[model samples]
Target chain A: MSSFLVPFLFFSLLVSSVFSDQAAFSSHLLPRPLILEYPENSVETLQTQLRQFDADELTLQCTSWRVAGEANNLNPWKTIPDECLEYVRGYVNGKGYLVDLQRVADEAVAYAKGLQLQGDGKDVWVFDIDETLLSNLPYYKDHGYGAEVFNPVDFDMWVDKATAPALEASLKLYQQLLDMGFKIILLTGRSEAQRAVTEQNLRSAGFQSWDRLILRATEDHGKLAATYKSEKRDEMLEAGYRILGNSGDQWSDLLGWPMSTRSFKLPNPMYYIS
Target chain B: MSSFLVPFLFFSLLVSSVFSDQAAFSSHLLPRPLILEYPENSVETLQTQLRQFDADELTLQCTSWRVAGEANNLNPWKTIPDECLEYVRGYVNGKGYLVDLQRVADEAVAYAKGLQLQGDGKDVWVFDIDETLLSNLPYYKDHGYGAEVFNPVDFDMWVDKATAPALEASLKLYQQLLDMGFKIILLTGRSEAQRAVTEQNLRSAGFQSWDRLILRATEDHGKLAATYKSEKRDEMLEAGYRILGNSGDQWSDLLGWPMSTRSFKLPNPMYYIS
Candidate 1:
């Protein structure tokens, strides 16, 4: 009950700020929940604060878990732990995740700036789409903050909406990489059929253009993300592109054969793709 | 300056609980400083608390940086940030570090316990010595908790003392691995010259035996740790031993070819070794 309450509390703040669905589903589209009318010193607020403190106590452990996940220590996890919900919510909605994302973008930008790129336009930066260049938070928040089993149906529904915002930090990195004479190649686990909406979403989210946006083909289904992405990378290598820097939110997007010289992992504690 | 005061404040709490230097450099070995004798609500305590609060505020960013380091995001870092001194100190000394260690050890032990070992006793779990098994915290505390520039001269001198203690969590994992019929291989960046003291230290710290203790040989000088460790792993493969589990606090210990089927990374924010 409190979990529901807290997310609702965070939800109001987020709809106005984080998500890019303002035009599609304006704030008034969802009615105001009656529970939020409670006074400042009410029991509901007290419960939320107490629960937040409990979550705070577990944050060090959660950061450890989250870091372990980032470092690929916790392998093959399907979903984020249920108990880390508040922690994850606080992280994603609060300052932590953004700060982490900013740092990653800074590092990647720094790496890009240092590169002596060949003038041949063959230099390319590979990026994974979901949670890398675009955030699906508007979808995930409704889907347990990735604590529940993945539902491909509504997820596809969310993708079809084509309103996934460009992760601000990644947008900055993308602009910088583009300015530095590097071709942007997005290799994502998203199905090839989603290309139209994906492109629409990318353009709307401020990603003007890319050298290539490669989505998972029908034959690419059933393969591990690492395997699929690796094959794509191999193909890029054959196409005469110098894979300079790779960035992703999952190890599957970065690992496997013929990886780039440097790969930056943006923080993504939500769902594990593989 | 506040920097020196914070370390000193943490110093008192640490000597009693954190370090295992009781016999060699007992609590009495260091004289009581005048400042510590202040009243409970004294200026020192209040200032320390206020500074601690400040450190807590930066912990999320620091955790992000540290996690980025773990995930190989922040590479080639020389030392912990001076600003994150209290944060690192709290993490390393408080329940957070031990809990993280326990979780890693537990995961590795669970993986080891599940393996169907061959009757040949050829399954080996490669372990890094410093920070992976026996900790060098007793020495690191004096050296700015790794915020200060590394002084290899004094560091080697401290290692010569043979007094490092077992990381309790890793020790438990070591014992469990041995019980599960896995050969323990102590492969470390420590020099071959320190074999005697390293052995003594291991025994005193409760690591009784191992299949082999591979250290950096004189001929292996100046090689990058990743290359050197990878070469050692290759040699192990050639020797017909199955590398089942590789555990380390550094990526250099886990990355490169012929890695274990499952490797666990223990956190080490104090320093970066590329």
Candidate 2:
């Protein structure tokens, strides 16, 4: 090799080594990933608070929960202050809430049409008694609009009087469901002792017929509200009932296994049940 | 009571009876509250799905989460498809996202300045690692933008590369915290084994110093992300660290106990861990 070529080759080698070393050096400077043991003191465990929403905000939230079938109980929201009760009333009585319900009901009705209601005693419709079929406006008005703690003694006395009125919108849907040959089944959280008054209330409220009115037995008191309702629906399914549609105010009423083909939710921000 | 005459008394008796009967009748027609036993099948307990939001909507949702510390996770959001990742990018890289961060940081700085930074070593600021201070954009660029299931192996390799860049805004805020004599503590969900790499990464990425860097332990693998993170913060509080401020990408990082006086959330629609 020529002397000039040897010098050039050595210079090129030097530059290449320097460039590679610089690249490696920079890479080495980068932070490596760390694996840490869970700190012993790190588990003080904070209690996460439920996100808060003001009354006006809650109207949209509750509406969303209702339509989605994961509604809170009929009771007032815990985070919302007492001053917001009037706003809750505004939402329940307002056109927007009603329109949304009508839309959901309309969708359920359309879905029911697709089912073959041959009346093999197989096509069943599940209905929640409170808020779904009956209106408790008078009771809540006299009470604290669901903000007050429930008094079973007072409420049962009201039930004993048995003068509850039918929810007008739900009544129309009920009659339509029956006319379409869907056997109606009523599931309620009311105690079994209230059966006589409840049955009387339903009849007087214009619910002319229903295949079954299932009430909670004394033994089922300790279970979750969702658990009891789900059992009844499951029993019906086991007995060869195909629940074409279900409607309720609380999510616990509608969610669970063996779900109906479609579920409709009505606006009820008055309470929540787990 | 019988002053008016026997006949008048008889009329009054009749009127009273009629009124009582009418009251009873009216009561029956009023809406009755139903008591439903919880459903049995209802316990098939579905994991509640997160609500959906479009790309434009997510920008707002993320902004809200950042400011308000309430956010929905990415899964089960039907509207956010894989293709709309560009929107996520737009929000994270855009002026709006940065502007919001700057606003939050400015508030924190103003807040910190007011605080008595007495160097008691108790006045400390907590920070979360990923997304809070460093941008994992390069890794997530190749991986699903938080839409796909997490593969630890792939993620670990990325961490090993230690190529993450410091989030410029966060770095600035971090320096401000240090300048104010606030002890800097980093708490992250990354495993303990990756400490060296992580430390190097932080330094290379422009984090000059911090008092402590905490990572999760192997035993904490199964614990809830929120629970684990919260416990850690609680410990810090017990040890005399007054957490004046905090910032993180996920709600888990901000929500735990011994909460900082204020928390700033960074936009991360990329994923959610609770």
Model 1, which residues run further than 4 Å from truth?
A: A1-55, B1-56
Query: Candidate 2 chain B — worst ten consecutive residues by lDDT sum?
Result: B44-53
Model 1 chain A is weakest, by summed lDDT over 10 consecutive residues, at A1-10
Write down the lDDT of every candidate, Cα atoms only: 0.79, 0.63
lDDT of 2 by residue, B19-45 (tens): 544434333322432112213332221
lDDT of 1 by residue, B1-274 (tens): 1121223433543342224323343444336652453344355543654454455346555666767788888757788888777667666766667878888887887777778999597788999999999999889888878899888899999999999999999998899888888988888998999999999999999999898999999978788888899899999899998999999999899888778778889988898887
Distance from true location, Cα of A262 in model 1, Å? 1.2
True contacts kept of 1: 0.38
Candidates' RMSD to native:
15.5, 26.2
In candidate 1, what are the lDDT values of residues A1-274, reduced to their tens digit?
1111224333533343324333334445447542353344344534654454455446556766887788788757778887788778777876677888998999898888888998898998999999999999989888888898888988999999999999999998899888888999999999999999999999999999899999989999999999999999999999898999999999899978888889999889898877
Tally clashes: model 2. Answer: 67
Worst lDDT 10-window in candidate 2 chain A: A44-53
Distance from true location, Cα of B124 in model 1, Å:
2.5
TM-score of every candidate? 0.80, 0.42
